[model samples]
Target: MSPIANAFSIDVEDWFQVSAFAPYIDRAHWHSLPCRVERNVDLLLGMLAEQEASATFFTLGWIAERYPMLVRRIVDAGHELASHGYEHHRASDQTPAEFRADLVKARDILEQTGGCPVIGYRAPSFSIGAGNLWAHDVLLETGHRYSSSVYPVVHDHYGMPDAPRFPWRTGDGLLEIPVTTVRWGGRNWPIGGGGYFRLLPYNVSAWGLRRVNAVDQRPAIVYFHPWEFDPEQPRVDSANAKTRFRHYLNLHRTEPRIRRLLREFRWQRVDQAFSDELEKACAS
Candidate 1:
């Protein structure tokens, strides 16, 4: 049997731009905060280089406009540069017009900065839900070939429990590749990365990926924020306790955990790792 190749993705935003910090830190003050994204992303680049791995980075246009060279560096390193919306607004918070405009602006900025046609997207904070399924059409119309915006697990902020845990096609023929989750205990548990990677034990996280690879017989998609590796980053004090814990817990350990994960499994960019699955999905 062949090894289970996984899709490793990175969401390229700084510490202050996390969706959980939105309520506490207004967008107007974003420029005033210390920018730590470039440093952390550079760290990710070195780590991936050491492992000989490629990844997909869903980047914000706001970041690209300020650091165009950084976006170019990601492309130079042979990673897929995908859009993460322009201003980091959730689909649920925006009208269809707003979402469409965001998509165009983001795709244009990413393509211009990275010098490659942006082929994928990841909605800010996985915000695509029943109320905003209209965003799917806007995505296809905007020319994205795929999206990794759906998290099948149930979460307080975003999820679609009935959604497929694997890759599937939207009604309009756009491939909707959901973030990884494992079916267990009559619920979809998040195994994709992000808070779950920090909150759970590393062995547990590894086990879930292994199970998804072994039992589900499908490639698991794992994603993390570049900020996860930066434990020295300044903290935001105004967020609620739940949000703070979710964002800050186990930060110092994230880099080592990532190194271990890379050594333990085979991973590549979303398009490369799941090409077969995506081809089958789109054809149907």
Candidate 2:
């Protein structure tokens, strides 16, 4: 394992909330889908506990309302509980007003349910980009101290290729931690986890993260969804070929990959991982 400790975070939403299925699954019909997040979260808890690793759960307000016990369990497990928005709406898709409303509602619900201040916010789909920097001001106004919303890559769906690669104070004064990447070929490559972690070979993923930690001498922020850990989750058949491939490719491999990830990296909660930055943000 590397000497640097990385931020391990979970985007706590079910498979149905994935943007790939947004076109097919009506948000209104979300309640009807068989909920698998609780089970998956339990699995994550067990894994983290076994390794004595801590992580942040960027959970949906909707999930906290429906699963207060689960939210409390996350906090009680000594993990950080943060917001992933109220309805899982993308920041890029929402107007500033809408984003503020969602931010406030989600943070409040998470704080109330978890009995802890929810200070971090990760946009749905890593949707905060050049088009929505205003969302950062809105997040600050709504009481979020930091965000892990920008993915520094050139992706078809979501990324800001020009964004800062490490945790930095945004112009808005909120600490903005873009997802981790390895700078090679004069370009930032995605290695921060999520679908990329599942799609890439385990050795490559481990090597990239190790390079980021030991060579760069910086902590990489690693993230994934709870649903990724649950290969048996109900599949959505209506997604297009590209979406299907991006979301479902190697679901069976994700769990073992995560197990390896835990053993290889020194992982800690997002908020705790950036505790100094957080305190500085609060003071300034």
Of the candidates shown, which would achieve the greatest TM-score relative to the real structure?
A: 2
lDDT of each: 0.90, 0.90
Give lDDT tens digits, candidate 2, residues 121-177: 999999999888898899888888999998889998889998889887877689998
Q: For candidate 1, write residues 1-284 as lDDT tens digits.
A: 22978999999999988888988898999999999999999999998999898999999999999999999899999999999999899888998898999999999989888889898999989999777887888998899889999888778999999998888888887898999988898999998899899999999889999998898888889999999988999988888899889999999999999999988999899999879766775576
For all predicted structures, in order, the TM-scores are 0.97, 0.98
Off by over 4 Å in 1: 280-284
Question: What lDDT does candidate 2 reach at residue 216?
Answer: 85
The 10 consecutive residues of candidate 1 with the worst lDDT sum are 275-284
Alpha-carbon RMSD, candidate 2: 0.9
Each model's number of backbone clashes? 0, 0
